[model samples]
Target chain A: SQTIHQWPATLVQPVGSPLSLECTVEGTSNPNLYWYRQAAGRGLQLLFYSVGIGQISSEVPQNLSASRPQDRQFILSSKKLLLSDSGFYLCAWTRQGGDGYTFGSGTRLTVV
Target chain B: QQQVKQSPQSLIVQKGGISIINCAYENTAFDYFPWYQQFPGKGPALLIAIRPDVSEKKEGRFTISFNKSAKQFSLHIMDSQPGDSATYFCAASPPNNNDMRFGAGTRLTVKP
Candidate 1:
């Protein structure tokens, strides 16, 4: 079975602080990874996606970036956090040519 | 612009009733439509999916109705239960497209 892990479950950080959220998948290799952000009571916004190691595609221009350091390890980072950057961050993966994605538990980030 | 649009941002349903959520897309190239369910503080999970080739697909209590000519699809939950209360999202994607476009979510509350 394939599973995704994301941490920390919740985060509270001050404005302008650096941020790092990590996600990893087990039981699969060369799967496509994606990052999505959902504001409270709002729609999900695509952040980034990677097809392979060292390859990332950003969907929107924002104060964040994503990296695929290893085949199953993805990281979301920001040099400086803003109040608007707080949201629920999710990591998902899909097999090549698969029908749907499997998502992680998600991280609730609060930029205070 | 959002590629997929979903309606009824919030819904209240009585247990044993039916819950319906609709979604529309403008992209004619989209070949896949999927619905996701998310509990509070958790990431979304793939609940059901339908391909453009099918008009309706049912899995247990869940059903997806796709109207290819109308460019719309809907999810129906029969005998809605309290455990089914959660947020639902609709998404669409074209063939070979690595990115999936999600609609604004609908929050469903089934009162027992």
Candidate 2:
């Protein structure tokens, strides 16, 4: 079975600090990866998605960026975080032409 | 343009009742419809999905009803329980699309 891992499970960052969240999927190759953020009591907002290594599409332009370093490794980063950046970030993967997606545990970011 | 539109931003139901969430899509090319469930501080998980070829699909207490001609779909949760209190999202995607568009989401609270 495939498993997705994301870390750190929870994060507290100061305003203007750098941010890095990593996601890795085991037992799958060349999977579509996505980054999403959910505000408190709100639905998910798609940030970015990648089809292959070094290929990323931004759904919404913001301070955050995503990268696919390897076939199974994806990273979300920001040079300087903003208060608005605080939310629950999720990383998900799906096989090409697959029915549904598998999501990681998620990273709760609190920017103070 | 936002391809998917969901209704009833929030809903409250009594235990053992039924919970229904509706969604409509503008894109006729969308051939896949999926419903995702998310708990507080957690990532969304795939609950159920349906292809345009099917009118309805059921899994345990969850069901997905798709209307291909109307470009609409809905999720029905039977015998609602407090454990089912969470946010539910509706999503649509074409067969060849790499990205899936998600609905605004509906927060469902089943009170015991």
Best by TM-score: 1
TM-score for chain A as predicted in candidate 1: 0.99
Model 2 ranges off by over 4 Å? none
- lDDT string for model 2 (B24-102, tens) is 9998888888999988878899999999999999999999999888888999999999999999999998886576888
| lDDT of candidate 2 at residue A62, scale 0 to 100 | 88
A1-111: candidate 1 lDDT, tens digit per residue = 999999999999999999999999999999999999999999889999999999999999999999999999999999999999999999999988887988899999999
Angstrom error of the Cα, residue B110, model 2: value is: 0.9
Best candidate, DockQ-wise?
A: 1
Candidate 1 lDDT by residue in tens digits, B46-82: 9999999889999999999999999999999999999
Residue A77's lDDT within candidate 1 is 100
Q: What does DockQ give for each predicted structure? A: 0.82, 0.75
Candidate 2 collision pairs = none
Candidate 1: Cα lDDT at A2: 91
Per-candidate TM equals: 0.98, 0.97
Error of 1 at A109 (Å): 0.5
